[model samples]
Target: MERLEKSIVITLCNLEKIFPPSFFTIMIHLVVHLASEAKVAGPVHYRWMYPIERYLLTLKKYVRTRSHPEGSIAEKYLADKSMTFCSRFLHNVETKSNRTERYFDGYYGASTHTSLTKLEHGQVHRYIIFNLDIIEIFRNLHIEDLKQRYVYDMINHFHIIDISFSYLFNIYV
Candidate 1:
């Protein structure tokens, strides 16, 4: 039990370093891992995972501030796609277990209440297309270890970007 807690802390710290702006990402990853493990271990294991629940509250605060404002291209795009993905994922998961809502709430926070207007919607769709193009490059790869490799690659890429941006921001400001 001590070792498991230590491992979780270590993983969270490493994830924090890689994804500096969002502790929530680490929490979501933990929940995904826990959810998979809990299938066999059962609900009693969640007591040990209570830290994740605390993090979900923190995530809610973070997301409220981080939301892409109405009319922004990035906001529009992320909103639409996230809604669609959430809907489908929620449906699929709910069919298998009631725990799905708890996990979704932990990850996405509150759902958007309304749909975007046509002009805003158009901008979002364009952003989605651009994102899909980038994703497609990864989809085409035939590597056997792509899932694990992709996570490491993404972490490395984000680390570089974070360092580069911090250096540049400090120089200008």
Candidate 2:
């Protein structure tokens, strides 16, 4: 700040014939106060403009129509906030959030065995890739050794695998 002030004063004192008096405008004067700005307002990032700019960008996304965009943004913002607040009190409300396995600590869903049955079977093109867990389950349930060997052969032969639904065993293999 002292360096900037020194430079500014030096430049003003040594104002050359090439530089016009109009160059010493209010904008130039404003640059001198920038050093003291952080003393008044914490930091540049934590200032009011940061959150305002973020909200402005969010509000800009709500504009579907070109006409009266501010009104549309305001309406959408209020509606979304109200719906989110209301969803907390409501039961069986479908909040379209992109989440898988909601709430880590709670026991909200069905049993582990029942949930496992709902998972898609791993596959590769026409060949199905059996899941390791399902194979373990099959071994416990006394699945044939020959069928297990066939599943292993399919896995070893084709490296590619995908999670898909299979109807043969009605299990996610």
Q: Best candidate per lDDT, number?
A: 2
Writing each residue's lDDT as its tens digit, candidate 1 over 122-155 gives: 5675455335665444333422233445665654
Best by TM-score: 2
The sequence of per-residue lDDT tens digits that candidate 2 reaches over residues 1-173 is 66765576667556644578877777766766776675677678776677888888998999877798878888999998997787766666556442336656766778665322322322232243244564555433433433455575654333322222233245644
Off by over 4 Å in 2: 1-36, 40-48, 93-173
Total clashes for model 1: 0
Query: TM-score, each model?
Result: 0.17, 0.33
Per-candidate Cα lDDT values, in order, are 0.54, 0.58
